[model samples]
Target: MVQTARVLTIGEFSRLTHLSVRTLRRYHEADLLEPAVVDQATGYRYYGVDQIPVAQVIHRLRELDVPLSDVQRILRTPDPGIRAALVAEHLQRLEGVLDRTRAAVVSLRRLLEPDPAPIHVELRSEPARTVAAVEAVVGSGDVEAWFAGAMAELEAAVGDAVTGPPGGTYDNALFEQERGHALVYLPATAPPRVGRVHPVTLPAAELAVTTHVGEHDGVEITYGALGTWVVQNAMSVAGPVREVYLVGPRDAREPAAWRTEIGWPVFRLT
Candidate 1:
């Protein structure tokens, strides 16, 4: 009689892997992972010692919340680079979810806090200025990325000739209805013809202005307060809203130090 390599039973494998027997069975049922051997008569499952690493990898990916289908693809792929790219893509998605979660927390905190701060608004007569701008119609979900990219292009086009802070004009539909036309501009002395950056004169207007400090996650609070002030003072909105990035991301590394000036085109009643 010849002695053979000892195969661990499902119970032993479960203990060694620190995974519940039920989960291992579920994985087997899903075809994501299967036992090394199964007793035909008893229907008992066993795993080879060599499969420990495979089980561990599956556990690690599950801990990261990778989708089952993606995990299956990752495990089935023989190319190391492809596996790494798959993991990286999932991590990138997780990062985006984290960003949205943080923003949601900020908005919720603003809503729950008592004694909303007073909004100080000023009337300013803005003069028309020449700007290198990019215009697009975008959904609210894509505004942040679009604004950042447009601003980058405008900044690159205006390089060294930027005369004033960066600003954006947003149609009312953007805030009220979630989709609209948007324009991001950099005031500069340069002429048009830099990529999508084109020369345009921002129209002069009487604006009700207020400054928002910190990241835009909670900037909606400032906008609401300003809107209330405008209505209470008998002012009617005349046109699209303007946002001036005074101490923006381009100037400061910390979001808390960023300053944005919000200007609503308004007509004051006598």
Candidate 2:
């Protein structure tokens, strides 16, 4: 008699793949992956020893948090180059998310640390100027990519008039929700059309502004401090917040040389 290959049941496959039975079932139901065999009467699933490698790959990809659709796409492609490209794209996205997370963490750390000098808030009027800008509704996860693209567009349009730093305007509700609209721009004498540009009239108002020196990673601390000052001085926010980039990353690659102004429009409490 000829010897046959061995097949493992779902429980055995789960142990071999280090994946929970529940997860395996989900993968099967999603048609993302299927067992090597299924019993006709008992309705039990079994996997061949040869299926172990595929299961491991699927398990690792899922661990990396790749979307089910992408995983299916990747597995369906037999071309190694195509599969590699898909994985690389996901990795780049993950890195961007990690960078934003690090920025938030740094901001939180600065907020918790002791400050020797009291945060100063000054009221000032800003002049209206043309700006090359890109506006979009972006979530925290998508902000990095949006910033990169917006900055590139601004640079291409400004050629030489981008004297000051790049900055942005944020709506008040952005912090509370997953989606927020941001208008990122480079200050220019005359607005130039790039990817997306529009003539916007920024109204003159009394603004409580504070300068943040160094990387923008911890700049949220400055915003928080400024907000605290506003409340303590009996003032209420009246409009959207504006960030004036006094020194841009393009001007100086050094994070220490970067200067940002966080401005919040406010009205005195009656």
Candidate 3:
């Protein structure tokens, strides 16, 4: 008769793996890890000693910030080459996220610890311009992918007119409904429509604008600060927010050098 492997209960397995019961439960829900046996009476989970390797792999992948869907795909792949390729792709994504996070931390630190020089809010008039743009209704979760595609389209369309950097505008309804419209554009003489192309005219407006130097993802915090400034200074918003990307990913510049202008149009209190 063949002998079965020893099975450990959830608590026992958690101790062995140094993972919390809650984390193990979440892994089980995500289908990233599963137990070897389950009790029929109480539905308690039991894990085989042999399953530790799989659990460790899942833990490491998650520590690397691999998306759950990608983790499932990587685990399901049987070929060594394919698995390596999948891991490489995930590593690239992780690096990008880490870079963005580091930039945000630096920016936040600067904001919290400012120099003696006072931060000035400037009111400026912006001129309207035609741009080659891609518009999409995107949620916060899906904005990264949508932005990648939109930026790729903008770079391709920009020939001689790439003089100024690219930027985007977000409508207010998006954050409220989890569905927001984003228009990524480059200044252009004529709109190009190879694919996912649209023409948008940014209207002239008087805006209270402040420059932020760091990752675009963390610009929301800066916006909050700016909004507070507007309200305290007796100003009400009049139009959608504009984010002008003075420097971008395509420029191959340092992360600290990336500049974004957060512009909020406003009207003074009566």
| Prediction-by-prediction clash tally | 0, 0, 1
lDDT of each: 0.89, 0.82, 0.81
Compared with the true structure, what per-residue lDDT tens digits does model 2 show for residues 20-136? Answer: 899889999999878777777677888888888888888888888899999999999999999999999999989977977987887777666786368777898777766678888
The estimated TM-scores of all candidates read: 0.88, 0.72, 0.68
Off by over 4 Å in 2: 1-6, 9-12, 21-26, 39-45, 111-117, 122-125, 128-149, 170-183, 193-195, 198-206, 213-220, 234-239, 247-258, 266-270
Cα lDDT tens digits for candidate 3, 1-270:
222357888999999888889999888888878778777667788888988888888889988888889889999999989999999988887788787888678667756875523446888889888888889888978888898888887787777766577888888777667788878888876777767877778889889999876667767767877888899889998877888888766564676687898888988896
Candidate ranking under TM-score, highest first, comes to: 1, 2, 3
Candidate 2 versus the native: TM-score?
0.72
Q: List where candidate 3 sits over 4 angstroms from the true fold.
A: 1-78, 96-118
Error of 1 at 165 (Å): 1.9
RMSD of each: 2.7, 4.3, 5.7
lDDT of model 2 at residue 126?
78
